[model samples]
Target: NKIVLPVASSGIAALLLPGGRTAHSRFNIPIDLKATSTCHITPGTMLAELIEKAALIIWDEAPMTHMHAFEALDKSLRDILSLHDPKAKTLPFGGKTVLLGGDFRQILPVIPQGTRAEIVSASISHSYLWESCHKFTLQKNMRLSEDEKEFSNYVLRVGDGNPLPTEVNEFDEDEEDQLISIDRTLVEELSSDPHKQILEATYGRTDQWKGTK
Candidate 1:
């Protein structure tokens, strides 16, 4: 296979990739930030070598990383590849094919005590690269069954902070600005033993402890 496919993520999610390759922080590669306008990877490292040879680079969990991380990589790639073809310096990702995938609903770039605006500011969308990005969406709820599709749709709507459909929920206009009320029975059960309830919810359903036990 001549095409190199290197998949990386911001964290341990890389272990879940097909071959379990290391996905260190974007900044883990040796770089010189001072020598150029943007960071450039130290020219002789394994990372630079692989990047030079790779046909495709897939970076997962894109939303969880800071915009600077992507900018750094873009800058480094362009600097490294431009040596062979000066025109490559003007292309995104140094004119190399790259796919970045993630959901914005998941964990965003973490900022200490950050207001909503600060957190959004640190995301990839806030980066200059976003202007060249082509977006795609998945309409089908593949993870759910035909019977559970209704619930899945409701969950997605809630995640997007969209108004729920009338069939799923109906609320008064006054209640819209306030927290929605939960069922009394569910509240009573949770109040009875909140700690145990949480523990069971997290670990009771799986064989996580069976081997040790």
Candidate 2:
């Protein structure tokens, strides 16, 4: 699932769902009222339902979640599976399969008062912020054209395995503005007439002067 708020989202978060699909409406995920996430993760009733129903739970673009956010989600999944009755107890999302998707180079979640979570976050050897293996990658990108795709592929293979070019700037960085501010002379010329002297000019020399050149 795209854990980001813009497209599909946790209903409790009331993220920017286009048509107003409630938390329970899209998938049976719910927030544990007791839990708060500094980052996005699978947990609580929401995570519980996913583990119970889905054979694979893929968390895409969620690496930016914070440590406590990860913790909350971890505890939640554990609680869900450990409980015999969902209402009565929580259980582990243990023995469950999960996949994470992200560029680790994109936007992140921001909780009320929390630090940004790190992906590849854990320093623990063989750590589990409740993550699973059996990983896969999408190698092809339809968005890029022949030149772009070919260049990107070569960069990925030769560079540090991540192909983004060095010149790629952060979203907040200044960009080359496309807008041009023409002087008043040009504006007046454009607004006035179809065959004004300069407008009718064929080149540096006008039609009247064309034969001279």
Find the candidate with the highest TM-score and give its number: 1
> Model 1 RMSD to the real structure?
5.2
**Alpha-carbon TM-score of each model against the true structure:** 0.74, 0.39
What lDDT does each candidate get?
A: 0.69, 0.43
lDDT of 2 by residue, 144-194 (tens): 787676555554544343433334344433532322233333344443555
Q: How close is candidate 2 to the true structure, as a TM-score?
A: 0.39
Q: For candidate 1, list the clashing residue pairs, or say none.
A: none
Best by lDDT: 1
Off by over 4 Å in 1: 20-40, 163-188, 194-212
Tell me the tens digit of each residue's lDDT in model 1 across 24-142.
44335432222123543576777677778888777778888777767877887888889887988999889888788778878898888999899999899998899988898867777
How well does candidate 1 score on lDDT at residue 7? 51
